[model samples]
Target: MKSILTMLGIAAALLAAWSARAAIYDAIQFGEPGSEKSHGLESDDSEVIRGGLDEPARILLPRAPASWQGGSVKFKLRVNPNRQNYVTLKLWGGDVNENLLILHADGRQVGYRSRGDIGLLDYGSPEPAVPGRFYYVTLPLPMSATYRRERVEFEIVSTGRIWEPGRTFEQYQKKMLTPSRGLYRFYVHDHSYFKPPAEDRQGARPEPVLPPQQPESFEALKERVNRELDRLLGPDGRFTNQMQLLMAAEAAGLEWSRACRNPEAVRRIVAGLDNCYLRWREDPSLASDDRSAVYPAWTGFGPAAEAVRLLHKDLGPYLDEELRGPDGQPVRRRKAWADMLEAGVRHLAASRSRHPKQSMIVDLNLYRNNRGLRLLDPSKGLPPEVVLGCLYESVGLEPWSGPLDGKGKPVLKSGGSDRLFTAKRLPKEFGYDGNDGELPALAAAIYQATRPEPGKPGDERILGVLREMIRARSFFRYPALNLAHNPVMRLETVIGWRDMQFPGDVTYVQRPESGASVLQAAAAVLEPYSTGIVQQMFGERQFFPSLDRQMEDREFRTTFGLLHVPEHYRLLTAQPASSSRLPMSEGQPDFVFSDEESGVLAVKYGSEILYASLYWRAPHAVNFLARIHHVTPVLERLATVRQEVEFQPSGRIFVRPGWTNSGVGAGGLNYPDNVRSIHAGETLPIARLPKTAGTGQENPLAGRGDFYKLLYGPYLFAMNASSREFTFTTPKNIVYKRLPDGGEIAGGTVLKVAPMSTVVLRRAR
Candidate 1:
């Protein structure tokens, strides 16, 4: 047989280099490489190796602590393939407790690529050849794995076994776990990751959250700044890395200093800042090719700029203070500040790959770092990529490539029913990234980057994004209970009625809590709903980290991009906070909001408030392909059982006659179906769920209760979170009433809701 590896390298030589150098030019950080064991010694078993017609052999990758960061494994093996009995491979591992390749990263939360998408040794497959002689193959490990220690694992399917036609690997593997009789052996060798760039990557300190926005008395401002100043001078404070506290000190510290008639406090702040500045500038770690550089740059720079601004008058002597950089360049402290700021900015700009086309890594540190740099070099501009940090574009909510058109007006989807407040981000009318926090974080960066100008807009386009985002997410708020008024319907991005499936693990219908942290602290635009989103996010969040870590694995950094967090809006501008918890209310003069693009209409008619999604948001790659939007994936505590079901929200239901999808396919493998089969009225029972995959009940989560419950929390408060409006039924209905002016029917379970809506009733006396 012709060989693919004859010109590449011999097996002996390939296996000899058990560890190779890092693959940095690839641009992704594949952690340090090289395996602990340096030998490719074959197994010493005396018996002849064999294979079972049903089960395959398992080969554990050599163990190395912290070394397997989304890399590949190269090994040598001796095998032969033919028309009938050829070898195939099935690689699998935990994406939670260990490393696993994460695919579909471009959409919502990326789907961890399930077992092996690697190689096959079938008739026309690429298996390094020599008939019965040995050859080499490389298996790349996944990034989002969940297993504890075994880090990486793979299998050998040489018996030419195939899961039943149309059956998935999930079902095939579930029914075939025992080691096969064909005990093949892999001569151990190299396990390594792609090389990472020299610039270190790390998270900035958590986005700072500030005190609420309430007009403060000079005395109050003085007291707060003075207290923060005290902490700054205290022994424990300097090491604490408290950026928020530091900014608070600046917000009113200057005034407080003047009020006390003491330049001493101001001087001390200057002194403290100078100390931090020099430490960061000279600390080789901050400027090195190592990982800590971005960390200090972001957390260190922003606060430093604010301090410098605050102490301008008092800095005559300090400005002349000289310092040496890590490179041994000596300059006045002011110039030194520019050098430090630029160094950090240049590094991040050089290293970061943040963009709409690639990853959703709106690193808060990068923005804070650049803001600090621009704060110094006023002529320099904020990175255009900063738009990603402010208005994120995910699988569903693809807001903008840039936030404006050539005319400099905000780019938004038309069809919002508001004049001033109705710029919609669902221009494409798609799903939402479950992270929820990213776009807000990016928008928050705009505030972090700009100084508050009276009538001037700082980076108008970016500011437009910030305003539009707050309006977009908060629009889903149903004021009375502060819960998600988001209108959603699944299409091809979701499961089909009978046999169709989308490409992603999640369709961008993000968690209601994605906007929670931002909601926790109110902002003017987040109004009416700032309190609402916060309540809604937290209310739903209580049900999870409910799924096991692996159930929905994603990039560690991607999680931080959700816009739900920004240090504090008050720090940016003094807009009053919606501090009051969402109060229950019937319509006062009729409150109404309509999103034509998203097909959502929210209306509060006195006591009867109704939220409805009249159509699918927009095009999803999944739905676009399937050419339908009838059936979606759903989970609810139904009139019968609790499980994830194929929902025809328009009232079409597919009822399977079984209690379990425990075993069905020829090899008993559970594959996803890509045919129109279920919708609103039908039940795609848990038993109907594939026997494998995240939505499947294959994992050890029995004690975790139902996975569907997390998504279908018709909570204790009569909140119906599912897609269908269910009768809040009771063993018997607990009745309630309204005053003579009350609008709707008295309620308990009698109240009805559209998907993700809520109803509150005052019980009758």
Candidate 2:
């Protein structure tokens, strides 16, 4: 009996020892609402889950102490179901930057520096997720001299899947007992001698947020500028490089010239500018080379052009002696400016294609025809319009090779081959489309170079071409086949749909499937011309005011171009008379409104009218046009509006609002399909028509149906809203069809409409 009792005592003692060996240390419960602030864990852009119906809170582990190194380590964790979680463990040596080893929950490990020299022990198996369950993972602790000195950190991340109906209790837990939002709870079980502090066993406080700074006063601003200048120009200044010093000096000179003429500042600026020009000027001998000698083509030509123009205008009289000829003789100030301009032009011109038929500058040697690969076929040489525009702008129209017609207008030579010119004419190769802003940009450059005066010989012709290019390339008209030929056109369509169909949030459009291409298109257009044609066009008041709509859209690239480019604001100072006006008699009406209190402008062509209202106090204004007398009152009520006029063959005129809704819930990723109650007596016009006929069959408006379709034009065009719905009254006995979803409006005096949706009415046979 005594021996049996002693055996039982020994077995109990051995069991107690085994339990102590399995004890967990440094445990963290993630979902406590206060844990985020209580713990020093930092989050990047990802949202913390915090315990919820379907989510678990995420916790980033703090850096481990050096004492925790050199042993086998095990991590026990509990995670919510339906989520794929990843935990990355990084072991650092001395500095955080000096990483020793990186271990992923997937069993992948990478060693860095001296740690790489030693073979890593295999971490058993990859961590697996058992729905709503706990899992354990073991890894041999890195105990090398490099690792013992450095420490470890944990980054826990999770992605959730959509919850489906009828899930098991384990798959979808109805109740969570822990305060920690559904995030994982973790504990470290280390075999090493090191132990964490008792206070740290709970959690650490979150980083504090800083308060915002107040605006600076005028005196404070002046002092700040002075300090910055000193820092840049002082003996121990950061601007020690020659380029930096020169830029600083030129800036100082310009500022002084504007505010108060400081002689010392002016002298320093002129000296710096001269030094820069001498060092950076293109070698005259390299003019024949096709490769761009200027390291960054833009910085070279842009600054040079600005400097020459400024020196000639502001300091020509004061520094005439500084302007020297190639022969080392002092040249006249104006003559020197002209010579510099001529030299720059010559260098650009020298890079042009030597082909007898080509004359436009070929800036991009990799692509033929100056990036207008579709417009100019290498076998057919340069287009006549491009050649004419370049020559007329640079030298004169006399240099053009085309034969003069009856009106003395140069006739385009098609290289003996009859090539069709139509909106649908695109290259067979997918990427060879000519819809890039490059064509319009080149046209604008040529137009500006023409130095257009009211009635110059080639001025009207150049302006006409430019105007056509802008209109044809613009999103004003729908593409013939709905196929986007290029990036700009694609962006136009995306913006149009967002503006018209989905107005409130762009998330639906921004999805990878839909919004990605739109973003790419915006970036492509904005990047190439933000500093060139886009700026110049805006400065010259040549761009349409409707473009301001892009500012309201949340597209990053579009917003960046509009905000980053300085010339976008030039429209504010543009002369109102410069707005394009189209004659109303030709079925085209151009409306211009002039009021100091409200800046409003509208241009109408075919079925569409582009309009914009600019005023901070009353950013919305209604414009009454003489051409559309019937719809003037409706037009006046809307601030920014686009009116579309459709004529049915049945002599019915259908005028409808074309702009997208700017209200909340109209612009997000999710589609808002619920109908809202609209007040009675509101007048609205349906602009889009059905693609199918009354027979419930597809209506192809080509061949047999074309004539009938043309005959059923718009006649009577007034729509009124009922107490809780939209209504349209037919003045004539005509059949009306709704668009998108094909349905006929029963013949009646008043037609009811479904609110918050696009409706197009067509005259049905």
Which candidate achieves the best TM-score against the true structure?
Answer: 1
Name the runs in model 1 displaced over 4 angstroms. Answer: 1-226, 234-245, 253-262, 281-300, 309-317, 324-330, 351-423, 426-430, 433-435, 438-445, 452-467, 479-585, 588-765
- Candidate 1 C-alpha lDDT tens digits along 417-507: 2221113543321222213222454454444444343123344454455655554544333221011212211111211111111211211
Query: Distance (Å) between predicted and true CA of 71, model 2?
Result: 36
Q: Return the TM-score for each candidate structure.
A: 0.36, 0.28
lDDT of 2 by residue, 476-574 (tens): 222111111110111121111112110111111011121112122122222322223233333323233223234345442232223212222232223
Query: Candidate 2: lDDT over CA atoms?
Result: 0.27
lDDT of each: 0.30, 0.27
TM-score of 2: 0.28
Lowest lDDT 10-residue stretch of candidate 1:
632-641
Model 1 error, position 618 (Å): 14
State how far residue 333 of model 2 sits from its true place (Å). Answer: 9.9
What lDDT is reached at residue 459 by model 1?
Answer: 49
Q: lDDT value for candidate 1?
A: 0.30
